[model samples]
Target: MYKLNVLDKLSFIFIIIGAINWGLIGLFNLNIVGLVFSEPVNLIGRIVYILIGISGIDMVLFLFKMRKSFKE
Candidate 1:
């Protein structure tokens, strides 16, 4: 298992935020990111979406695989 540390904490926080954003979209049919990012038709918003999606993919992968960087 991975040792808990600052980076771990920050990643978990981002995962939480990503989860909440998806929940809002599914339940309320709302897009907090779209509203916040505004002009999704442009470049910056696309980059933001890509980053969020990547983070989500990583979190999902981590859930099934216990991190093994922790040493004896």
Candidate 2:
């Protein structure tokens, strides 16, 4: 439970940041990854994007488990 709880928190934070970044990209044509890392194709930006994708998958797993618990 401790590990999962910590992971959930971390994943949530990542997801929030990813969502906000996407919103900026969509509404203002801002390239957060590009701006921060000096280029969107940089290794750091790629890693960030990968982690964001993983966090999203983790959040979905969390939600599925939560729903299962509620159904019990």
Candidate 3:
């Protein structure tokens, strides 16, 4: 089993949120972030988007690190 630290857990949470948002958009044409934060293109919404992007990058790095560890 793999152990995840705080940062990994946070990234996973953000990623899951992003995925759900996308699913809503695809299935219902709804934008949850936009609804919660007002216009999805606005400042707060943009900040949330940026955080999600950073979380995705973190997850990618985590995957690489895990792959390397498993090979050792």
Top-TM-score candidate index: 3
* Per-prediction TM-score to the true structure, in the order listed: 0.60, 0.87, 0.89
| Model 2 poorest ten-residue lDDT run | 1-10
- Candidate 2 local lDDT, 1-72, one digit each (tens): 224688889899999989999999999999787798876368988888898999999999998888878787
Give Cα distance to truth, residue 65, candidate 2, Å.
Answer: 0.6
Ranking by TM-score: 3, 2, 1
Residue 28 of model 3 has an lDDT of: 100
Model 2 stretches astray by more than 4 angstroms: 1-4
Measured with C-alpha atoms, the lDDT of residue 44 in candidate 2 is: 86
For this target, which candidate reaches the highest lDDT against the unseen true structure?
A: 3
- The C-alpha local distance difference test score for the whole of candidate 3 amounts to 0.93
Whole-model lDDT values for every prediction: 0.68, 0.86, 0.93
Q: Deviation in angstroms for 9 in model 2? A: 0.8
